[model samples]
Target chain A: MRGTMLYAPFDIRFQELPDPVILEPTDAIIRTVATCVCGSDLWSYRGITPFTEPHPMGHEYVGVVEEIGADVTGIQPGQFVIGSFATSDNTCPNCRNGAQSRCIHGNFMSTCQATSIRIPLADGTLVPTPDQPSPGLIPSLLTLSDVMGTGWYAAVAAQVVRGGTAVVVGDGAVGLCGVLAARELGASRIIAMSRHEARQKLALEFGATDIVSERGDDGVEAVRELTKGIGADSVLECVGTAESMKQAVRCTRAGGSLGYVGVPHGVELNGEQLFRALIGVRGGPAPVRRFLPDLITRVLEGRINPGKVFDMTLPLDQVAEAYAAMDQRRAIKVLLQP
Target chain B: MRGTMLYAPFDIRFQELPDPVILEPTDAIIRTVATCVCGSDLWSYRGITPFTEPHPMGHEYVGVVEEIGADVTGIQPGQFVIGSFATSDNTCPNCRNGAQSRCIHGNFMSTCQATSIRIPLADGTLVPTPDQPSPGLIPSLLTLSDVMGTGWYAAVAAQVVRGGTAVVVGDGAVGLCGVLAARELGASRIIAMSRHEARQKLALEFGATDIVSERGDDGVEAVRELTKGIGADSVLECVGTAESMKQAVRCTRAGGSLGYVGVPHGVELNGEQLFRALIGVRGGPAPVRRFLPDLITRVLEGRINPGKVFDMTLPLDQVAEAYAAMDQRRAIKVLLQP
Candidate 1:
């Protein structure tokens, strides 16, 4: 199997690797149908996150089951499926509570941007599509594995109440999807904080009612002004930088909730500030599996087009180009067809 | 008028002070019906929190309106009312959203442990009782000013679902009130963390189904064991210390919510830990005004007895003793007749 590996910062390569096979009764091997580069991937690609040794790349994928373990149930070979970035038994107390990402036996889906891979806890982690999706739907189905679900989780965590205003910080793929999720959740007004034209356009298409082309305190002021000085009722923080977090917290109205899914980087929340803000804070890794069924239903029903986030798509051999495009901000996301 | 003043750590005195008079058109002067020592008061009284000047010592009180400013409309002279420890306009964005403590025009109700105190934003901050209550109801009504309401806020913030399990840290008066609040909110099983015999007894009486005397890691393990290793569905963090906060977070199941009403002291949360735990954290100064009306009705109907927390009482002139009793933990709470 040809897999993507990050040997060092900016040193991504496609190399031959052994094909994955079921190692446990709960595992299944799947042939990758689609995969993509994530914003967080850039953290390592840009050397911001230390990459000590060669590491397998990609955790998000839409795949077709190639073989199933003896104990696996509900999923079978030849079925198109969506699996979360992390594998979970889905029956643990945490998984049952809709926090599969924190599952006791959870493991990251490593080396997944390849032709084939083994998924542990197949029965609990994989959700099959109604049928083999068309190529057009593959890109969107791939997103359901992580980005889309993350945005949905963000909206839910933020308590984006129906008929309320929702502000999404960060114009990355996740943030764009948040606008869509906020809209799907019935936020009457969606505010996207973006300075980039392409991302801003995508955000508007994804249901952003307003776009504030500013950052930091200025951005907070812009959001406050939009909501008549009260700030948004719900805020989705897609960027985990300290500044973005501060902006997210500041732009939320008193008692409003903020869902942060960007994975905090150097973010330190002052207790006094949070106490005074009285904001309800809830977010972490997206429990993508929890929202899969509903989101899959929505996608199949033609209610949303989350796949629009994939601005570029390349053949499996062009994995390096996919990484470069996203690395240089040339693409919001790059879908890889394997 | 006479009020309790903290001259220094462990140095409390009943000092003569000028009688409060309306200083704003929205102000009302209330003659103290009942006042009590709060757990937070010990922060300064024990010198854990610095006491620089001779500060007026009380904030919690239930009283009768003795005089009102021209603009005060909802409250009238001679009306028994429940006023939050902090005054708020209640019409501001924050107050309208149920965070009256963060109201744009909010102000702490200082110098309240006196014969009379002035309350600003009277119409918005005061909730009149159905009628003048019996002397027995005064203590419970006094709790509405802070502690009881704070506990109620904690439960609400934790989103205690009907028939869910609730774990409360900190067995002080507020935590005891949280047990009562959890029961009122329909939690089927309430766990109270307490080592003190008196606090444990009060907790059981207030509807705690279990008590865990262990603190820190052991306490978390105890809660986990009680919940069949899943942890509590809702946890109330009533103590602001770092250890208490950590225990509260650790004892909560993934996806469970925690409401921390204790003003955080020496508490710093690592984003990674919280993110991995995937617990929802929300709290601050309780928006007591929001819950005032409901709590008042419950107290008036003989449905609850939050006043039972007051195990001792002292005359206004014995203010020093009132502070001493609470400071020494000799009394769960001490009510003052002013």
Candidate 2:
């Protein structure tokens, strides 16, 4: 089997690797049908998050089950499926509470950029499509593995409601999806904060009612002005930088909420500021599994097409190009064919 | 008029001061019915929160309207009222959103300790009781001005629901009130974290089903053990220190919420820690005005008795002794009469 590995900063290698097999009774091996590079992948690829050893990369994929462990139930071979970037047994206390990302028996998936991947907790982690999806739907379905679901979680966490306003503080793929999620959740006003023309256009297409190109205090003022000086009822922070979090917090109205999904790098929140602003904050890795079923249905019903986030597509062997293109801002996201 | 003044640390003096008069059309002068020493007053009393000059002290009060400016409406002279520590123009955006503490036109009341208090936004700030209450009900009704309302806000912010579990961190007047609030909200298992035997007894009387005397990590461990190792569904942080905030965070289950009513001092939250725990945090000065009507009704109906927290009583002239009792931890809370 062939897979992608990061040898060092700015170095991605797609080469021959041993095929995956069930290592535990709860595991299943799936043959990758499609995979993709994520914005988070750039963290290690840029060496911002250093690594001592070369490691397998990628956490998003749509695949076809090849074999299942003896103890695996509710899942069978030859089925097409989509799974969360984080694996969960789905019955633990946290999972039952809709926080599968924090499930006691969970592990983040890090080796999905391969021909064949071994998935633990298969019965609980993977949700099968009613039938094998057509090629066109594959891209959209693949997004359900992380970005789209994360965006949905962001909207849910922000407590976005019908007839309310929302502010999305990032223009990345996830942020674009968040615009769609907020719209679906019935936010009457969706503001997308973006300076890039192309991303701004995509945001509008994804249901953004307004766009603010300014950054920092100016951006906060713009949002406040748009919200009648009260700020948005909900704000989705798709970037984990301190600046983005601060902007998101300032964009939310008193009694409003900010939902942050981006992995934090060096973000610190002041208790006093949050208290004075009366903002409710909830953030973390997206509990993708919790939203997988509903999102999958939404995609299959053709109600959403999040695959539009994939601006570029490449062969799985060109995995290096995928990382480089996203790193250089040449691609919003790259879908990979395995 | 006479008022309590804090000249410096440990230098509280009851002295003659200028009588308060209406300065705004919306202002209403109230004769003090009852005012009390608050835990927060000790911050400045202890010189932890410094003041540049001698200042009038106190924020909690249940008073009778003595005079009203021309524009004041809905409240009449001689009407008994219980108002929030923070006055608000309830028509403001924040107030309409149920966060009156952050109202656009609002101010924290600091002159209530005096014989006469000038309240801004009189029509919006004060809620009249059904009628003048008997002396026995005054203390309980007075609590709606701050402590009891704050505890109610903590439970409300934590999203307490019937049959859920709650953990109250801090055994001060507000925390004891939180135990009562949790019970009123229908929490099946209310855990009160208190090291003081007297406070523990009061908490149990307020409907706490369990008490954990441990502090810090040991306290968190004890809460976890009682909660089936999942932590409580809602945790109230009534102490503002960083340690209390951290303990409150750890005691909440993944996807649970922490409502911190404590006015934070030097508290900084690491975004990464909160992200990994999937904890939702919301805190601030309680919007007591929002809860005044409901709480007052509860007291009038004899459904609640928060006045028990005031174990000691003093004449208004003994304001200095009231502060001393609370400062020395000799009284849970002290009620004052003019």
Candidate 3:
């Protein structure tokens, strides 16, 4: 199987790798139908997140089960399935509490950029489609594996209330999807903060009622002005930078909630500042597995088209191009057909 | 008028001061019926919080309105009233969102330890009892002004679900009140963290079902052990130190909520740590005014006795002694009869 590997910063390569096999009784092997590069993956690709050696890339996928371990239940060979970045038992205390991403027995699905990948805890991680999804629905289903689920988690974490205003801080794919999530959650006003024309257009298409083109304090001021000087009722932070985090908090009204799903890179919160700001703060690795069922339903019902976030698609061997497109912002998100 | 003045660290003095008068049309003057020294006040008295010149002390008070400015409405002179440490207009966006403590036109009340104190935003800050309260009910009513209100805010911010377990970090008056608030909010189990026997007794009486005396790492371990390694569902962080904050966050299960109402000192959060912890964090200065009406009703009905936290009482002129007792931990709280 050909897989994507990052040996060093800006060094994405497509190389032949051993095909995956069910290694554990609860594991299942899936032949990838679709996978994608993520904003977080760029952290390492851009040399920001450190790595000592090359490793398989990609954590999002929608595929068909090719083989199943003897102990695997509910999932069967030939079934089209969607699974989150991490496999969770879904029965642990944390999982039961809706934090399946932090499941004690979970492991990140790091080899999904390959033709075949093995997923552990298959019974808890894989959600099969009602039928074999058409290729047109594949990208949206793939997003349920991570990014779309993550955006939904951000909206949920922010406690987006009906008729309330919600602000999304980042203009990346996740942020655009957040606009969709906030809209689906019943926010009457969705404000997307984006500087790029293409991304801004996508944001609006995803249900953003307003856009703030400024950055830093000016950006916060813009959000405040838009919210009539009180700040948005719910702020979604889809960027992981310190400045983005600060602006997200500043753009939230006192007693409002902020859901930050971006993997923090350089973010730091001053205790006094956060305390005085008086906004609820929550977000982390999204429990994507938990939302898979609902998101699949939404996609199947044609209620949402989250896959619109993928602006570019490439064959598995063109993995480097996919990474480059995302890194250079040429694509909001890039899909790979394996 | 006479007042307690903090001349310097450990140098409290009884001094004659000009009587307070309405300086704003929205102000109202009140003669102190009961005032208390707060745990936060000790920060300045101990030189932890800076102050170069002598200043009037005390922010919690229950008093009788002596006079009202022309603009003051709804509250009449001679009414028994409870007011929080801060006065808010309660009409601003923040106040409308239930964060009255951060109201746009808010100001902290600092002359409450004196015989007479002027409260700004009288209509929004003061909540009057049905009638003149008997002397026995005054102390409990006084707690509504700050400590008890703050505790209630902590419980609310933590989102204590009925029948869930709540862990209160810190055993001070506010923490003890947190136990009571959790119980009132329908928490089936309340764990009070304290090393002091007397405070522990108060905690138990206030509805704590268990007490964990361990501090720091051991404390977090104890909580996890108690919860079968999952940690508490709701954790009230009543202490604001970095260690306490970290322990509070650690003792909370993934996806749990942590309400921290402490006046933070030297606390900072590594963004990655908080992002990974997956706990909802919310709290700041308690919006006491928001809870005033309900709390007053509870106190008047004799459903709770939060004033038991005030173990000692002194005449207004003995303010120095009152500060000393609380500063030295000789009293959980001290009431001043002005």
Candidate 4:
């Protein structure tokens, strides 16, 4: 089977890798219908996160079940499914609490961007939408796999109250979607911190009421001024950069909450400051599995169009171009049709 | 008026000071009926926390309202009240949300140790018992002012779950009461780290399931081991020392919550570690005013007896020895009568 293999630093190759097979009783093989590149993927692509092992890349995907293990339940062949980057046993205590991504049995799904992929914990991790989704719904449903769920986690973790202000720190797809999420959660105001016009415009479309084109303390101050000196009641930090995390922390009002979903690089928390202000901080990789069902319904209902974050789309043969475009800022997110 | 004042390190003197009057429209002059030394006072008495300015020192008090300003509503003169150290309006958003300590108009009682003290925000800050309590209930009621509230805040902040493990990282009155708070919050397992005999015994009575004599990482490892390889679901960090903070962080489970009410002397948060672990940290000075009503109800109903933390008592003239005994670790918590 032809697949994308990450060999080493700045190295990705289109090579013939053996097709994935069901090695466990809960495993199932799915033919990838759609796969995409993620910002976290860019970390390794930029060589900042060095890969020591040669492995198949990509974790986000929408697909059709091709085969299933004898014990695989609920998920059947010919079903269209979307799964999170991480696989989880949906029945674990953590999973039952709507944090499947932190399920005690949660593990990284193998290379999902490929002609065929194997998934474990099929019943618990995968959400099968309708047998067929409208062409208009593909983009939005695609976003549910990772970006949308990640954004929703940020908004939820921040405890974004209805009729309250929320600040989003990051211009990435997750950040923009966080704006949409804050709005969905009933936040009356959403502030996006970004200078780029394209990103800012998308943020506005997603539901941001204000934009602070500043960084660090200045960004915090701008948000504070906009929120009438009380600062944001909730802040969603989607940019994994340290500076964005700092801004997120500084921009939250005393006794407010900060929901950070970005894969933090070097962000530091000043305990004294957080303690004195009484602000709460909570976040992690999105528990996409927990959110996939409602998101799928909302997307199918055409209530949300989060797929707009995918500015560029390509086929399997042009996967390299998709990576390059996203890495060079030519695209916000790249979708690959396999 | 004769009142207690701390001139400097090891110098708590009873001297003549101005009789507190209603300085604000909402102010009330409370005749100090019962006041107590706090664990935090030891920090000042031992000079670990320097007295930047000379002032009265006690913040834990249950008093009789001697007089009230004309504008002070809800509270009448001659009522016995058990109020928090910090007075709050209780009508602001923060106060309404059960964070009265962070009320917009609240003030920390940094200098409330005297015999006759003025209280601001009289309406929202003071809660009167159904009837003036007997002497035995006075000490227990006084604990509601700070230490008890701090412990309750820690437990609540930690999100202690029923039939789940909780690690308490301090052994002061607040820490011991945190063990109680965790129990009240339904934590099935409470592990208190302490070497002191009295506090540890009280912690057990308060429902601490285990005790860790070790400090720092060793204590954290012990907690993790007790939780069957995962750390505690909730951790109540009552001490603000850097060591306690580290233990608090280290002992919490991944995706777990830490309720830290410790007043950090000088502490920092490692954002990189915190973000990756997805730990939730929340706390500040206990919203004592918010919890006062409920705490008073519990004490009146005999559901909780927090006065056990106070092992020694002295008259107002002997307040100096009260501070000295607490500083020398000869008492868990001390009570002073005026």
Error of 2 at A89 (Å): 0.4
Candidate that would win on DockQ: 2
Question: Which lDDT tens digits does candidate 3 get at residues B1-338?
Answer: 88888888999888888888889999999998989899999899999999888888889998899999999888999999998898999888888999898899997888788888999999999998889998999989999999999999999999998999899999889999999999999999899999999999999999999899998889888888888898888999998888889888998898899999999999887678877868888979999999999999999999999999999999988988998898788999999997
* Candidate 4, position B102, lDDT: 77
Backbone clashes per model, in order?
Answer: 0, 0, 0, 1
- The list of candidate 2 runs beyond 4 A from truth reads none
DockQ per candidate, 2 decimals: 0.73, 0.87, 0.81, 0.57
Per-model CA lDDT versus the true structure: 0.90, 0.94, 0.91, 0.85
- lDDT tens digits by residue: candidate 4, A1-338: 67887777667677778988889888888998888888888888888986688888888888889999888988999999988888998887667656677778878765876888888888787889866787667878888988999999899889898998899998989999999999999999999999889999999998999989988778878998998776888999998777777788889887889999988887777888888778899988888887898998888887889999999989876777888898889999998887
What's the C-alpha lDDT at position A126 in model 1?
97
- Provide the lowest-lDDT 10-residue window in model 3 chain B: B268-277
Worst 10 residues of 1 chain B by lDDT: B268-277
TM-scores for all candidates: the values are: 0.98, 0.99, 0.99, 0.93
Q: Comparing 1 and 3 by lDDT, which wins?
A: 3
Clashing pairs in 1: none
- Between which residue pairs do clashes occur in model 3? none
Interface RMSD of each: 1.4, 0.9, 1.1, 2.2
RMSD of each: 1.2, 0.9, 1.1, 2.5
